[model samples]
Target: MRKPIAPRTIRGRLLCPRVDTRTVDHLADGLVEIDEQGVIAAVGPAPAGCAVPETVPGTVWLPGFVDTHVHYPQLRVAGRSSGELLTWLERTVFAEESRFADKNYATDVAADLCRRFIASGTTTASIYGSSHPIATAVLFAALDRTGLRAQVGMTLMDRDAPPDLCLEADAALVACEALIARWHGHDDDRLRFCVTPRFALSCTPRLLEGAGRLADRHDLPIQTHLSENPGEIAAVAARFPEAAHYLDVYARHGLCTERSLFGHCIHLSEPEWGALHAAGAAVAHCPDSNFFLGSGVMPLRDTLTRGVRVGLGSDVGAGRTFSMRHIAASAYDASLLRGARVGPEELLWLATAGGANALGLGDRIGHLAPGYDADLVAVQVQVSDPADTAELLDALLFSHATEPVRNVLVRGRRAV
Candidate 1:
């Protein structure tokens, strides 16, 4: 049997986005108390009679990064770019995914995936499994063992792909139902099952419709790709000729709800932007993957201007690395290329608080606060001896490639 964790208080020089706003809250000296339930019971400077706090383990403590989109099976496929998104999928991605049918192979990779998440300082995420249900099950079991909070989905691809990788809509839904029964709401709801259609080009109309209805019945979150590439967009148009636009194809099948998360929305039309805002949906801006695959830069400003919820996604395999901080660094580059001046505070928010909000877990896990889960990272990062918030953020993001995560805590439990 597992032993109960003891409650403790820790002091730190911390910086995190506010739970109520995008602003960062920094304290050169601060204290936080985590209760037996693994919730932050108190957080602030020492009050009178608040037992002298223990020092934090790293240079600064920030809320753990939340990755809004990524693929579990593609962990080993990073950096094998084949010129474009669709061609890369055909040449590099699907072949790697097909190996997941071997349960042993899937299990080994899942363990590595969890380690990478911990090493990179991600406590919460939305992940994609390969089309195989057992492979997705393998992914969930690994996440559960590691104590990470994530929403995982099995990719649903019924048509327009290789036969070995494709399963009919009804069969795929049956597989999904089984996975849901086993993993949904497991372990005090730390993990959830998301409905994932592999986009319009890969899914049959039946698969898309059934996925939408299943999510409605189960009240689950949904994740899928959107207008990331122009060629891919044209193909989606050809595949769903009757639909109004790329986003409308999802809307037609009831998948464009507030619970939906669309990745790489680069070439969205004005009306599509309006629709995303009106539906109260969210977006996963995978700038690293966009640049890696020659997919055009997403107009980050357009998504922000529409007041749509947006979060950073590593979008790995194609996206270079699993670190969301690296993705945040790339987001700045993408923004600069698009002629937008997205601030460091905002980028920090997007990597942590904004991602949790995008995943609809804002109050539960985003920022450092009393009543929030102690899901945070301790990074050994510094540009100045006692770096201010801006200097700290810049160093953390810009030096992400080398500055490793010093410590990680999930619900106050040490995960690394």
Candidate 2:
């Protein structure tokens, strides 16, 4: 007679983030005990006398990546733009997003987006839905079934958008309210509704303020764009004459707070940096998108030195890939261009733990250890047996050679 083994477990070579940039805990052969509630009960060297799943050598188990800023409706348009931000939006982006108004089209995209997330090893994400409420609802429904955690928002825009993509302030707010009521805290808060105001230029003052109020009333996180380009900056300045600067437009309207996540802050003045730090808000640094659009590089070193939180984003359609590894590679290049050396350990941290921290889910995610949610990704590095941490990271994060994700788990549930 065979006795059934107890405790659920997974094992492999592990690189666990302590949520500290200075070091990463690498266990050459490690074990993670997952509990009934799907939290990591214990993680370290595998215990003797306890039979466990066969450990896979050369498979590195790391935290599932948290994508801080991505647009769900813009998936199809990812690699099409060769021009700068505004022109590309008018010529290519708007039309693609407008098609989401069709329910069937939105449904298909929603399903495909979920599969793409799993394939890319993304478990948690902060996503921007299109301006259409029905399309956003379809997306939430799709995500709900797939066990992916996300905070989604219908893009709130009342001006300067194509007619098909624009929703009046009042109407947009109402739709947001409806969405929040249905899915704000679904599945024990695994999914949430965020307040997304597409950026200062596209949203009117009233819409932005209303969005801020809605987020406040529900205590939701906010996501928006910042100083990503020069012309965009000038346009923002022209649109809001009274604003001290571009950041102030959101600040004045109550969008700047500890729970805010601003994307592509590549260009900023001294005061802007100070204010951003003081507000306790975070940035979703999309190096891939910055390079794609020829936007200026974000001063990663200066920003981190100022104690501002940052997370990596695969700002798709604009960023070029769904893989965070690609984003990490681009981030390294960005730092080198700025004369700052950012190694693979820190870039790995940015892609996982840093992103979790930026999105206010640090305690639960960002690391693989006891008391943390069991969201993990197993990547088969190019080098089967790496000599050291640097070698491991080089193959894992920086190299152009693609590494396959062997397995993926979200809260101990296998998504792939």
lDDT of 2 at 99: 98
lDDT of 2 by residue, 187-290 (tens): 77788999999999999899999998998999999999999999999999999999999999999999999999999999989999999999999999999999
Work out candidate 2's RMSD over C-alphas: 3.2
What tens-digit string does per-residue lDDT give for candidate 1 at 201-255?
9998999999999999999999999998999999989888999999999999999
Kindly report which residue stretches of model 1 are placed more than 4 angstroms away from their true locations once superposed. 1-4, 47-54
TM-score of 1: 0.97
**Model 1 Cα shift for residue 159 (angstroms):** 1.2
Q: Where's the lowest-lDDT run of ten residues in candidate 1?
A: 50-59
Residue 386's C-alpha lDDT in candidate 1?
A: 61
lDDT of 1 at 412: 82
Checking candidate 1 for backbone clashes, the offending pairs are: none
